[model samples]
Target: MAISIFGLLEVMLLFINAVAILNEERFLAKIGWGRQAANPYEQESVKARIVNLITAVSTLMRIPLIGLNIIVILYLVVLG
Candidate 1:
């Protein structure tokens, strides 16, 4: 149960971090993901891709976690 809670927290952190990265240029640059481009369009393109990747990974991790939580809840309710 503790581990499951920890996993949920980790997933939540990932989502929060991803949002921060998307919203803050300085934060993204601090992590070296904010790239310098010759044009504004190119810079936006790279930034969007990086943000999308982070969002995808976090969402993918979350799906399995949600399933695990549902399974655990069902088990507890049905068994006890």
Candidate 2:
């Protein structure tokens, strides 16, 4: 089955983001932050800060991809 260009682009964007998150998690684990916690608020705060940074950058990255997806879907709908 052939995937639409927009669909392929969307998959690629998601794949890249997943890889980045995996890498970030690995790096955090390497630095002793194995995962989220609840005991120490400071640890949770650090994780939250990292999450906020990732979310900010991901939002910027997603804006263009989302715009592209919308444009492509609209084009397909209009042409079809």
Candidate 3:
């Protein structure tokens, strides 16, 4: 029972790690795309603001996911 549970835990950890890695990659890609996007209205400050805006929103959204992931990891460890 415990061994199966550990396997499940490993899978979950891999999933979360993949999600985190994907998110980071997506974040970088978005930043690069945004930088290259044509926009006459985008001044230096506006570009900075847009970058920060995207990052802030993404970070805020990811906070709960990360917290839940941590909780699950802890739960699995304690379950052992």
Candidate 4:
């Protein structure tokens, strides 16, 4: 039962991660493929900063999620 619950949580996290990645790509497209603008100020605008932060956070989330997923898979294969 606990394993099943954890598996469900993992799936939810994976979905959230996918959505975050999609949003990041969308934001980057809106901002010109993450290119730096000619105007320095434009390069550091609020939208740009928010996108950067989101990228960083989503990247960080990926590492742990991948690790957790591997652990869960191994657990199921070895003991399920």
lDDT of each: 0.57, 0.59, 0.59, 0.65
For TM-score, candidate 1 versus 2, the one ahead is 2
* Cα lDDT tens digits for candidate 3, 5-56: 7577768666655544444345655656343453557656665566555555
Model 4 Cα lDDT, one tens digit per residue, 1-80: 35667777878877766745655345766766453432456757776675566666576777786777788789879988
Model 2 regions more than 4 Å off: 3-7, 13-57
- What is candidate 4's TM-score against the reference? 0.43
Two-way TM-score contest, 1 vs 3, winner:
3
Model 2: per-residue lDDT, tens digit, 1-80?
Answer: 88888678768766656634544455655765443422355644766666556555555656566666577678769986
Using lDDT, give the best candidate's number.
4
How far in Å is the alpha carbon of 59 misplaced in model 4? 2.6
Q: Could you tell me the lDDT of residue 77 within candidate 2? A: 90
lDDT of 2 at 38: 23
lDDT of 2 at 56: 54
Q: In model 1, which regions exceed 4 Å deviation?
A: 1-57
TM-score of every candidate relative to the true structure: 0.29, 0.32, 0.32, 0.43
Task: Name the weakest run of 10 consecutive residues (lDDT summed) in model 1.
Answer: 34-43
Error of 1 at 17 (Å): 15
In terms of lDDT, which candidate is stronger, 2 or 4?
Answer: 4
Question: TM-score of predicted model 1?
Answer: 0.29
| Positional deviation of residue 15's Cα in model 3 after best superposition, in angstroms | 2.8
Q: Write the per-residue lDDT of candidate 1 for residues 1-80, one digit (tens) a residue.
A: 36677567657755655553363355655665544422456645766677556556555655665676576568668975
Instruction: For candidate 3, give the lDDT of residue 69.
Output: 76
